[model samples]
Target: MSFSALPKIGMGTFRLKGNDARDAVKSALSLGYRHIDTAQAYENEAEVGDGIVSSGIPRREIFLTTKVWHDKLRASDLINSLHDSLTRLKTDHVDLALIHWPSPNDEVPMSEYLGALRDAQREGLATHIGISNFTCSQMDQAKDILGDTPIFTNQVEVHPFLNNRKVIEHARQLGIPVTGYMPLAVGKVMEDDTLIRIGAEHNASAAQIALAWTISKGVTPIPSSTRPKHQKDNLDALKIRLSKEEIAAIDQLDRNERIANPEFAPRWD
Candidate 1:
C-alpha cells in the first residue's frame, strides 16, 4: 500500500478493553482517525469492532489492522486464528494482518507461517499481509520466503528513548514503511527536558514532539489514549514539524531500550 494512503498516525488499541477500548476508538474516529490498530493478543477486537460500528463510520473508510499471536504461527492455527479475529473484529476483511511476532524459540519456521499469511490474503481474509517484531535478518527472510508478495509494514516498539534506527534504516533500505508503537515512550518522553524545550518553542507537548519525531522519520506512530484531549493531542502531532537540530537531539537519546521484547523476540540487529 502507498504511504500516502496509509495514515501517518494511527490509534493503537493495546491493553485497552471493554468500554474503554470501545469508547476510545469511537472518539478517535470522531476526531478524524481513519486508521485503527489492534492485535489478537490484546483480546479487545470485539470492543474495537463495537466502537467502529458505533462511530457510524463506514467500514470502507477505516483502515483496520489486527495481528496473529506467536503461539498461532502454525499454518492451520494462523488461518483459524485470523478467522476468529475477523469474527471478533466484526469485519469481513482487515486492511492489514500481521504475524504478531516471530515464533518463540523457532517453534515454527518463518516460511511456514508467512506462507500461511499469504494464504490468508489469497483467501481475501486480509487485503495486505506483513510481519511484526521482526529483526532485519527476519525481514530479509520474510521477503525471500514470500517472493513477489509485498510485506506491508513492520510494527514494532519505537519511541524517542528507543529510536530503533537500525531497523528503521533497514526497512527504509527495503522500501518498507514501519509502524511505531509507544511513540511517547510509554509517557517517559513527557519528562525529557530536551523534548520539553523543543515543544515549548512550538506550543506543543513533549508527547507531541516525540510523536512528530517518529513521523519525521517516515514511520507511523500508533499512540493510544482514552481521554479525548490526549487523543486529540496525538492526532495533532501530525502537524508538528521538527527541525534537523531538534530531530538530531532526539536521536541522541536512544538507549536501545526495548519495551516489547518477549522470550521469542529475534536477536536485535
Candidate 2:
C-alpha cells in the first residue's frame, strides 16, 4: 500500500484533555486538518467526537483514528473497548485502529489481539488494522496472524532526535507505512541547533523542520497541538521540502533520545 495517498500530516491528541482536547480538535479541523489521532488512554475520545460533530463536516470527509489500550487485549474485551471508543468518538467506525502497544510481558498471544482486530474489521468496526510500538519481529508475527488482511500502518516514535531508521526501513521493505507519533519529540527537537540551522534555510521553525524531515524520510507525521497557530504551522511542513544535503545534516541529530518511553514500553535497542 502506498502511503503517498495518506495524509502526510495529522493532529495527535496525546496530552490534551477535556475541553482543551475538544477545542484543539475543533481548531485543527477548522485549520484544514483531516486526520485526527487519539487513543483510549487519552481520556478525550468523547471530546474529540464533540469537535468532529461541532466542525459541521461530514464524517466521511474526516479520517478519524483511535487506539485500543494494552490492558484491554482480550478478544471479548477488545471488541467491547472498541465499541466504547466508537461511542465516545461519536462514529460508527474508525479509519484505522491500532494495538496501542505490544505488551510483550502480557501473556496474551499476539494472534489473540491481532485476531480480534481482524475480526473488528470483518465486522465493519474499523476500516484498517495496525500495530503501534511494535518491533520488526513483532510486526512479522502480526503479519503472519493477519494473513491477507492489510495491516495499514505501524505507529512509532520517529523524530529528528530519535530517528528509528531500522524500523522505518523494515516497514518500508514490507510495504507497511510508518506513522511518526512524536515527530516533534515533545518540544525537545525545537531547540536543536542542527534543526534550527536547517530551518533557517527554509525560513521554517525547528518544529516544522523536524516534521518535514520525517515526511522526507517517507514516514507520516502526527504532531499534537492545542494551539491554532501551531496546528497551521505543522501543516506548513508539507509546503517545505528539505534537500538531500539538508536531510543528511538533520539526520545527524539522531541521539536516540526518546520522549514517550513509559516503563512498560518495549525496548527498541
Q: Pick the candidate with the highest TM-score.
A: 1
lDDT of model 1 at position 212: 94
Give lDDT per model, in order: 0.92, 0.89
Model 1 — TM-score against the truth? Answer: 0.97
Which is the leading candidate under lDDT? 1
lDDT of 2 by residue, 83-197 (tens): 9999999999998999999865856888899999999988989988898999888888888888888888999999988899999999998788999998998898888998898
Q: How many residue pairs collide in each prediction?
A: 0, 0
Candidate 1 structure quality by residue, lDDT tens digits, 67-99: 999889899999999999999999889999999
Against the hidden reference, what TM-scores do the models get?
0.97, 0.97
Point out the worst 10-residue segment of candidate 1 by lDDT.
Answer: 1-10
Candidate 2 TM-score to native? 0.97
Q: Which whole-number lDDT from 0 to 100 does residue 123 have in model 1?
A: 100
